[model samples]
Each structure stands twice: as structure tokens, then as C-alpha cells.
Target: MIGIIDYGMGNLFSVSKALERIGVPYIISDSPEELNKTKGVILPGVGAFKDAMARLQEKELDQFIHQYVDSGRPLLGICLGMQLLFEESEENGRFQGLGLLKGRIVRIPDRDQNGERLKVPHMGWNKLHFHQEAPVLHDIQDGYVYFVHSYYADGIDEQALLASAEYGVQVPAVVGQGNVSGMQFHPEKSSATGMQLLTNFAKAMERSEELL
Candidate 1:
């Protein structure tokens, strides 16, 4: 089973529905004890970085997540949740993140190379370019995924970057380091490609269990 950490910021309904459609069992909980029962955990969010981090810290979910990851269990952070995995963010003044991955989140530049003003919140479908191999990316070569964020992860360790998408600028679309993974796009809403990615994650969880 997978635990969906609900700290009152994520798109819980959509994420849980997506997991259900994929036939993966999941439990949504704010209690760390309940989350500890699952083999894998997913941190999903759709809100401001500062607010989300504050909520996580308020509930002590941040510390629980660290302990969870340290156990070598797989943890996937989606969208805003992905940003929280970094060191800090500049969304609304500098704020500390979960520090799961070495990097910082910065706002996407407003202008392109041609000095043309680009829209913020880079909403819509974008093609993904693989940077390296990962179990969560199994059977997914390269394809488009839905993205809807204004900030992007930067100064990331090259070894931890798994995939990216271009939108006048390179966006870190998929990222993972060992048992921790993150998706900037909404895989739960990316159609077949999204479903496939979620399926791959479920399969990875299964594999991890088999080994244990």
C-alpha cells in the first residue's frame, strides 16, 4: 500500500483517484503513524511553497518524511511537493525546504532568449527529455506531460536529474535520487503518459517489496 501524505495542501482527491484507477491501494493520512504502515509514500501539493512547508512542519510531517526516506522506502513528491524536496525556494522570500535533494527552487524567467516575455505558470503539455534511467521511468522513453508551475528547480545535482522539459527554458520535469522521486507535471492528469508513469511507480514499489 502507498500512503498519501495529506498536510492540507495537496490535490488529494485527484491523486487518490489516480492511484485508484491504477488499481494501487493507498491511504490518505496526516498521522505519521498511519503513513508508516505503507510501503511507499507520495507527497502531493498544489499551493504556495511557504504555506505548504509551514503546514508540513506544523504537523511534523517533514521530520516523518525524512525518517521514511532514511529507511530506503520510496517517496514521490508531486508538483509543489517536488519543490519542497529541494533546499530552499524563492517563491515568497527565501524559505527552507525538506532538503531531500540538493538544490533550490527559483521562479521561471519571464523572458525568453529573444527577450520575448513568456507567460508565468507555464501551464499546458510539454515534451519530456530523459536525462538518465530510473525504475519509475520504465517503459517511458520520452513523451509529453502536463505542467503547471511558475517556479522550477535549479542548481540541481546532475546525477539526481532524471528528466526535463523545455519551455523557453529547461524545466526539471522528473527528478529522483535513490528511493526519492519527484514529478513537476501532474502525472495523474497527463493522460496515458501520466498513467504509465504512475503505473511504473507502482511497479517499482512492488519490486521493492519483493526484495524485502
Candidate 2:
């Protein structure tokens, strides 16, 4: 039984529907009790970083999420959920994150070395170039995943990065460090490729322990 954290901020219907499409049994709930017992937990969100953290805290599920990930069980964060896994974000101002991964979120440079308006929120589909062969992206080749975000995680070492995507610049699309995994793109909205990636994630979640 996989649990999707229902913090009232995620793309709930799309994510839930996608999981169902893969024939994976899942429950969406905000209760900590249910979260503690689930085989795997998915933190999905589509909103501001500071607001999401506040709601998670208000619901008292932040600590439980941390404990679940720390327990070595597979925990995946999607979109804004991915940002929460980092140390902090500068969306509105400097705000602390869940610190599941050692990094901070920053937007892409408006201009390159040559100088040009590259745009802020990167909204479109892009391919993921795997940093190294791993199970999270197993059975999945480099393909496009839907992304729509202004802030990108930065200062992360090469070791923790799983995949990169092109958007005028290379953005870390998929990231993993041990049992914790995250995707800047919304797999639920990436069509066939996205569906396959989610299926892979479900299988990874079922594993007793990650193979690395």
C-alpha cells in the first residue's frame, strides 16, 4: 500500500489517477497514522515552498515524513514536494525546507554568458539524461517529462544527482540519494513516458531495500 500525502497542495487527482492507471494500490491521506504504516510515501505538491511547509507543519506530518524517509523506506517527492526535500528555498524569501537532501532551490539565470532572457518558470517537456544507471529510472529510457517550476535545486553535489534535462540550460530533472528520490517534473502529466517512470517508482517502492 503506497500512501500519497494529501497536504491540500499537490496535483492530487492527476497523481492519484496515474497511480491507479499503473494498477498500483494507493491511499491519499493527511493523517500521520496512515503515513507511518504505508510501505512507501509520496509527497506531491504544486505550490509555494513556504506555504507547503507551513501546511505540513500545521497538519503535523512533517516529522512523520522525515522519520519515514530516514527509516530507509522509499520516499518520492514530486514538484514542489521535491523542493521541500531540500535544505531551503528562496521563493518568496529564505525559508527552511525538510532538509532530506542537502541543497537549496534557485531559479535559472535569465541570461547566459552571452546574455538573453531565458524565462523564469520553465514550462514544457524535456528529456532526462541519467547521471548513472539506477532503478528509479530503470525500464525507462531518456524521455520527456513535464516540468513547470521557477526555482531549481542548486549546490547539490554530482553524487546525489540522478538525471538532467535541457531547457536552454541543463536542469537536474531527477534526483536521488539513497532511499530518498525526487523529480522536478510531474510524471503524472508527462504522458506515456511519465507513466512508465511512475511504474518504475512503484516497483522501487516495493523493494525491501534499495539496490543503489
Candidate 3:
């Protein structure tokens, strides 16, 4: 079973529905004890970085998450949740992140390579370019994924980057290191490719369990 951490943020309904469609059992919980009973955990969020971090800290979920990851259990962060996996973010002033991965989050530049003004939030479908092999990316070749975010991760360790999208910049889309992983795009909203990715993650969790 998967545990969806709920600290009063995230598109929980959509994420839970996706898991249901995939036939993966999951529970939404704010209690760390309940989350500890799950095989894998997913952190999903859709809100401001500072506020989200504040809530996580308020609930003491931050410590639980760090400890969970340290135990070598699989943890996936989606969208804003993904950004929280980084070391820090510059959105609405400098704020520390979960620090699961070595990187910083910054707002997507408003200018293109030629200094042309571009849209702030890079919304819509974008093609993914794979950087390395990962279980979450199994059977997922090149394809477009839905993205709706104004800020993007930067200065990330290239080794942890699994996929990226170009929107006048190399936006970190899929990133993973060991049992911890993150997706900037909402896989639950990315159609077939998204479903496949989620399915892959579920399978990966099963494989991990089998090994144990």
C-alpha cells in the first residue's frame, strides 16, 4: 500500500484517483504512524513553497519524511512536492527545502535565450528527454507530459536527473536518487504516459518488497 502524505496541501483527490485507476492501494493520512505502515509514500503538493514547508514543519511531517527516506523506503514527490525535495527554494524569499536532493528551486525566467519575454508559469504539454535509467521511467520513452509550474529546479546534481523538458531552459522534470524520487509534471494528469509512470512506480515498490 502507498501512503499519500496530507499536510493540508496537494491535489490529493486527483492523485488518489489515479492510484485507484491503477489499482494501487493507498491511504491519505496526516499521521506519520499511519504513513509508516505503508510500503511507499508519495508527497503531493500544489501551493507556495514557504507555506507548504511551514505546514510540513508544523505537522512535524518533515522529520518523518527525512527519516522514512533514510530507512531506504521509496518516496516520490509530485510537482510542488518535487520542489520541496530540493535543498532550498527562492520562491517568496529564500526557504529551506526537504534537502532530499542536491539542488535549488527558482522561478522560471521570464526571458528566452534571445532575451525575449516568455510566459511565467510554463503550462501545457512538453516533451521529456531522458537522462538515465530509472524504475519509475520503465517503458517510458520520449513523450510529452503536462506541466503547470512557474518555478523550476536548478543547480541539481546531474546524476539524479532522470528526465527534463525544454522551455527555453532545461527544466528538471523527473529526478531520483536511491529510494527518493520526484516529478515536476503531474503524472496523474499526463494521460497514458502518466499512468504508465505511476504504474511503474507501483511495480517498483512491489519489486522492492520482494527483495525484502
The list of candidate 1 runs beyond 4 A from truth reads: none
Ranking by lDDT: 3, 1, 2
Clash tally, candidates in order: 0, 0, 0
lDDT of 1 by residue, 47-146 (tens): 9999999999999999999999988888999999999999999998999999999999999999989999899989999999999988888888558899
lDDT of 3 at 82: 97
Q: In terms of lDDT, which candidate is stronger, 1 or 3? A: 3
lDDT of each: 0.93, 0.87, 0.94
- Between which residue pairs do clashes occur in model 3? none
User: For residues 70-109, could you state the per-residue lDDT of candidate 2 as single tens digits?
Assistant: 7888889999998899999998899999998989998777
The digit string of per-residue lDDT tens for model 3 on 1-212 reads 99999999999999999999999999999999999999899999999999999999999999999999877789999999999999999998999999999999999999989999989799999999999989899898657899999999999998999999998899999999989999999999999999999999999888877776
Candidate RMSDs in Å, in order, are 0.9, 1.8, 0.8
- The deviation in Å at residue 128 for candidate 3 is 0.3
Q: For model 1, what is the C-alpha lDDT against the true structure?
A: 0.93
lDDT of 3 at 131: 92
